[model samples]
Target: MDEDYDYFQELRDFLGGTFHQDISSPEQALDEYINEANKECLLFTIRYCDEFLTSNRTKQEKENYIQTNAEIYFPAIGLTPLIWLNNVVEQIKEAVKLK
Candidate 1:
């Protein structure tokens, strides 16, 4: 990756800059469900995941990073830590593929 290639920014751009919105929900009007706290929490998680991916570290190292921050980052989201981690990883992978 180039020095200017930011995974967090890339992910945000791929998401049309609403990286905090509920893209997973199938609701017709998302604004009805937009919770400020939830959005802030998602932003942190996404930024951490971006750090995970862009670090280019080994699997063990990445998992360690997540585990270390698990308590801080995984509480606000409704899903379990493992599920949220997997979903974010998959989403970022798909985003990378698009580029």
Candidate 2:
């Protein structure tokens, strides 16, 4: 995809497509739940990117870290954690390239 893709927009689109019915505002409870989950994933991605940039971890180690943490991050969001991580990593790489 485009190098300048917005991870949050991709995430929102993924959720909207996957859980279209559940995301409807009429389903207030479910909508709120999904929103919270989306927020958590976005927050986690930002923090992980910052941490990855500062850490001395090797690329493999960084991938492993994401793998290990996938369980915690994927439960509510429903997307496969590895896929989400890969997208986030790509975004981070692109950001670094522009810096």
Best by lDDT: 2
Off by over 4 Å in 2: 1-34, 37-45, 72-86, 89-99
For each predicted model, how many residue pairs clash, with residues at least 3 apart or on different chains? 0, 0
Tell me the tens digit of each residue's lDDT in model 1 across 14-65.
3333333445441222222233225444444456556756676776665554
Question: What is the TM-score (0 to 1) of candidate 2?
Answer: 0.31
lDDT of each: 0.46, 0.47
The list of candidate 1 runs beyond 4 A from truth reads 1-34, 37-48, 72-84, 88-99
Q: Put down candidate 2 lDDT per residue, 34-94, tens digits, no spaces.
A: 4455444544445545555456766666555554533233555554544554555565444
Alpha-carbon shift of residue 7 in model 2 (angstroms): 20
Tell me how candidate 1 scores on lDDT.
Answer: 0.46
Q: Residue 77 in model 1: shift from native, Å?
A: 14
Worst lDDT run of 10 residues, candidate 2, spans: 22-31
* Residue pairs in collision within model 1: none
